[model samples]
Target: MNQPESSKSLFLGGAAKATAASREKYVPRMGEESALEEVLVEDVAPVRISAFVGLLVAISSFTAAVAKPMLVLPVLAIALCLFALRKHDGRTKPVGTLAARIGLVLACLFGSTGFFVHHLKSRTLGNQAVYFARQYLELAARGEESLAIELQKTKPNRQVATMQLNEAYSQDESAMEQLENFRSGAYVDVKKAGLDTEWELDRRPRVFQKYGREKVDTYWRDPSGKFNGVIQVELEWSPAYEGEEADWHVSLFQVERELIVAPSVL
Candidate 1:
């Protein structure tokens, strides 16, 4: 049977009102819960990239002894550590404080060591070797053979030029023969080259420190007959006990030896 239109309209209106009331009661609670969750969530701070990189750089800087270019890494690592510290705040905490500190210490130690080694090898020891070699050769050129040989003797036998002038070694045939064998052909020519011919320093072909002594291979040349010869000189340094400065003594001397250029002197 067909029902009345008015009755059906009344039923549908009641159902719509019930649906609207249910939505109004539950929607506000869901929105409030979402807002509360958003407030409770915390923000995480990011790790500073530089701090980690600085640590790595500091460790690699140990190679500065062999690779001179890496010596500058200490300064870089220190700067990075400082910058990392500056950016730290209540909200953004630095993550790797321990690593940064360790990096700083290592960088300083290796950096200083590298510089000291370079100075000793390039300047202090090299100068001592050349100075002793020059004095020894000059004596040989002037016919002071016995004293020249004495200069090359080890620490105990070597004598200073000024102190030994008064007391001379007894001149004899054996001494002359020894001089002839030690410094006869090329050695004599090299010594005499310094006297008459104007010579130029060809190069310092090698510099080495081994077994508690410094050794240098130096070459010299002149326009007179194109004199080219290699001389090897060794010097030992004695710590200052009696004098203000370290006592440097010539430990060994040789002429016409091969000059080999090694990549790593250390």
Candidate 2:
């Protein structure tokens, strides 16, 4: 009976050893799982930051399409997203990568749109200048000297007014004489040539070296599409004063008359 009891005790001890070996074998895998969880947590932080920045860039870019002052915001957001993408090379989160790409595309699209709007505004201004020039010539042709002079004096900045008055009286004395000629019908030949006819722009207007001034070139064509001559109109722009809207006025008007100097007989 004593021998049998000792053998039973030895078998129980061996079973306990086997259980300990199994637990030891699994310890490394548990450690590897814990390490993987820590890596995943670390990668998520940058993705959250990038997503937030991308949202801001999209909103600002839309606003800048109408509001000119908000143009700088998209530029800043794009820079920050690029930095985040570079910092975490192999472990870059998907959210972060997507955000960065969207931000870059929006910035480019809005920036180009802003430039096109500006160009259209400039062209509209040029067309307006040409219209005013034609009006001035028509007024003078009707012998409305006072009205023509009043048209020339249309709203101008205080500084521009002083400079123009000085130039009109002191430097370009012939300016008044030229207007007198127009009032006296010296340009009747030109009037017959359709000088008072509506003209279309020949090309894009040019801004001169002088500030607040633009030069517009226009042409009048016959019904048969025959090129008549070119007209050059100069305009000066003035900022709106208190209780007044901004205005543009004609400063000079000249016509490059198309001459038919017959070829000299050879």
Q: Where does candidate 1 have its weakest 10-residue lDDT segment?
A: 35-44
Instruction: Report the number of the highest-lDDT candidate.
Output: 1
TM-score of model 1 (CA atoms): 0.51
Q: lDDT of all predictions, in order shown?
A: 0.63, 0.57
Q: What is candidate 1's lDDT per residue for 120-147, written digit by digit as tens?
A: 6667666665676666556656766667
**Model 2 ranges with Cα > 4 A deviation:** 1-99, 154-201, 204-229, 256-266
Candidate 2 lDDT over 100-149, as tens digits, reads 77777777677667656656766786677667666755654555454444
Q: Show the colliding residue pairs in model 2.
A: none
Cα lDDT over the full model 1: 0.63
TM-score attained by model 2: 0.45
